[model samples]
Target: MEIVVSISDMKVTSRAKDVIVTHALGSCLGLAAYDPVAGVAGLIHCLLPLARDSKAPQKNPAMYVNTGVPQMMRAMFGRGATRENLILKAAGCGRMMHISNQFDTGANNFAALQKLLQVNEMHLSAEDVGGTIPRTMRLFADTGRLVISSCGRSWEL
Candidate 1:
């Protein structure tokens, strides 16, 4: 099975398949976590930086990185994944635009996610972030492998 995730969303692919997430990312971010032993992989598309701005956590929780990361992890765990065994990696957070735009959503998004990860006692192992180009990220669940392609270049994470 293959799955594709949209912006500000997340998806967990089955152990027997691969997952792909795409699109133009300016300030948005993409996160992919996998448990190699269990063959479970998850992908999150974060639009903004943090979940702190919202008064209501449940409504539109995907809009914030803080809320979105945890939600994605919970969903993956529901499918029989262990937190300690999972390998976390991130991409996007591209500054395709400039930071002068109001609050600098791109930088804020990355900072928010980093803070959230710190609070959760988790840290990212691999990252391809903070560039001026967009990316297409793919995760292979069977092998717990990740591939990121951008600007005619590709790499494994």
Candidate 2:
């Protein structure tokens, strides 16, 4: 079965047959982590770069890159996925539109995610990020395969 991770959301599973996917990633970012040895995988869709701006963490911790990525990682680790064995992949961080380009939210989101990953001692094994077009990201739990697609073209990582 396939699990759709919505914006400001995440999902983790150990089932080999499960596929975690997030669609229409424009300026927003998609972060994925997988552990092939444990057969565990997770996907997070983060909208902004920080959660500190929001007073209510319980209301939506998944809305920010800072909070969401680690939350999802914890979920993956709780399911037997080791930090050292985790393979990270990221996508999105697009310009998306020419109008209203004052703040590059995508770039900021991606940068914050990178910092968070580094602080966690995690590294990205693969990535498909930054463009004007939108994208879709998928993580296959069964084999820890990540596929990113855009403009009718797909790349496996």
The segments of candidate 1 whose C-alpha lies over 4 angstroms from its true place after superposition are: 52-57, 99-102
User: Can you write out model 1's per-residue Cα lDDT over 87-114, one digit (the tens) per residue?
Assistant: 9988888777554666777778888888
Q: Which ten residues in a row have the lowest lDDT in candidate 2?
A: 94-103
Question: How far is 48's C-alpha from truth in model 2 (Å)?
Answer: 0.5
Instruction: Give the 10-residue window scoring lowest on summed lDDT in candidate 1.
Output: 14-23
lDDT of 2 at 103: 85
Task: Give the per-residue lDDT of model 2 (tens digit) for 25-72.
Answer: 998989888888888999999898887765745788788898888888
Best candidate according to lDDT: 2
Best by TM-score: 2
RMSD of each: 1.9, 1.4
Q: Which residue pairs collide in model 2, if any?
A: none
